[model samples]
Target: MDPKETYSPLNCPKPVAEGIWIFDGLMIRMDLGPFKIPFPTRMTVVRLGDGTLWIHSPIAPDEDLFSAVDALGSVRHVIAPNSIHYWYMADWLERYPGARSYAVPDLATTAKRPFRIDHPLMDGARFAWESEIDWILVPGTKVSEAVFHVPSARTVILVDLIENFEAAKLSSPLMRFMLKLVGGLDPNGMAPLDLRMTFRPKRKQVRERLQRVVDWQPEKVIMAHGRIYDRDGAQELRRAFRWAI
Candidate 1:
């Protein structure tokens, strides 16, 4: 799907599953001091049994987006699934002051900006929607990304752990070159080569964690970047992590 066409700040929330909705936001130009490039990003919203919402990897919220979310349910939890994804936490917090914010433990020390983390996400931690949702921390990387599973929808939610960029969608040659170098370009793009290297000595642990996800047999996989895997998700996941496993 073309992110520009599908996700807009002015567009309404798109339903991905029964209780799950997704919002496509503007492409983020990742700036690393000397290096800068744009990458598409997305956010997910999950409504729990109590009618509370869980905002994951939130995008920049505007008045319209906020109003749309409010119509669904009260925002109860804002989750920064990983370190890099926490930049928008402050924005969400300001909008939903009553909502609790949660982030991976590493973000508390690694993140440069200030944000309140009501709770640190732990391995195998359970939530109010435990019966329908499950989560796991993909260990061994500099950033331990938390992957969530919605059993009811047979969907798996990911942050930066896996990416699938389409070359045509990249507007800049530099961005395309960078994505190619990191193996982010589809159709077989998996974890970046550098990220895979970070798992050295702990590849076994990382592989084990991925195995659990594979066993879930997801029918769809939603990621922060690239196209969402709606068919053969389980096979695609295994292929994406082949280097690590």
Candidate 2:
């Protein structure tokens, strides 16, 4: 019933890089085969060169949260980086009608509700962020995720590709164990066991894509569902994908 138990001090925007911030929001449970798992929600906002926001995996929004976000800049581009993470896109667009939406193409069929995608999350589209942000699609999953590298900030933003749930944040040993069973335990987190399996058939493609990310030499890595890897990011990226790479 309490979101703070999963992600505390909610509805606040915390800075990640000079032009980037992360907002923590509601708690949610996702079904992983037969198990229902609890996870805290996080979203990233990048103030592009035009001063409009580039949101990735938007969290549930409240008026207050919207106002705080508006102060950062006009909400211009809302993104559903992957299929499963598109849940709250509708809530966001309803408030910022001027904001254009973009999502993974696979979402057209996977989404339970109709999601408006103004563009595909593709690179070389001449997006405003091109000078600062480079992107690529991490293939080999039903819920294809788009990963972004902000060279100016040395940050890489991700949704669902990795989950590093900190042990101290969980209230129960059982919950921690269950989370670990899904490969979400901190310091060793990668995508959940089930998600990684999806890459088995295309591990080479996944590995090649991940290696390109590792070469970015990121200094900070941000995740939507767990702790942020704030240092040694490129190394962390390599370690997390070690199993398949």
Q: How do the predictions measure up, each by TM-score?
A: 0.91, 0.94
Q: In candidate 1, what are the lDDT values of residues 112-227, reduced to their tens digit?
A: 88799888888656666668678888766586788899988898998877888777787667777877887878887787776677777687888899889888999889998887
Give per-residue CA lDDT, model 2, range 101-139, as digits (tens).
Answer: 988878877799777788876544556566778888877
What ranges in model 1 sit over 4 Å off? Answer: 1-11, 31-35
Off by over 4 Å in 2: 2-4, 122-126
Q: What is residue 2's positional error in candidate 2, in angstroms? A: 4.4
**Which one is best on TM-score?**
2
Worst 10 residues of 1 by lDDT: 2-11
Clashing pairs in 2: none
Spell out the clash pairs found in candidate 1.
none
